[model samples]
Target: MATRVNVTVDAHLAIEVMLLTGTRNPQDAVELIVRDYLERAQRTEARTGDADDGRRSSDLQPYQPPQG
Candidate 1:
């Protein structure tokens, strides 16, 4: 089951998210972002056996936005 949500974001940020996720629809872009975030958080928690601290591991580099 899926829930409907109403959200507001900066247009430029939305556009960037859409491009980054290769999603043409704004809703899809938002869903993709949320899913990715949740999955990453779960993985981090599992690896550290603690709540996600929002810190990348030393072995992992920060993600950079794609260059045009």
Candidate 2:
């Protein structure tokens, strides 16, 4: 079973986002936005050395820096 959610958004922005994403379903759009938000939050936390449960993006070896 899926839960129904109500969200308010800017009408103009919604149209532009829908066009750019090529997804007609509002849920798809919302999922895309939420995915982006989570990714940015995770990266921000990683940059700040916010170790979660003694694990972070660096601990997972997910990022590689250039070496000279």
Q: Could you tell me which 10 consecutive residues in candidate 2 have the lowest summed lDDT?
A: 50-59
Across 20-60, the per-residue lDDT of candidate 1 in tens digits comes to: 99989888898899999999999987878753565546558
Which candidate wins on lDDT? 1
TM-score result, candidate 1: 0.68
Q: What is the lDDT of residue 61 in candidate 2?
A: 65
Off by over 4 Å in 2: 1-3, 51-68
Q: Which residue pairs in model 1 clash with each other?
A: none
Segments in model 1 whose C-alpha atoms lie over 4 Å from true places? 51-68
Error of 1 at 32 (Å): 0.1
Error of 2 at 16 (Å): 1.3
Q: What's the CA error at residue 68 for candidate 2, in Å?
A: 40
Per-residue lDDT of candidate 2, residues 7-53 (tens digit): 88887777777777788976688678888999999999778765565
Error of 2 at 61 (Å): 31
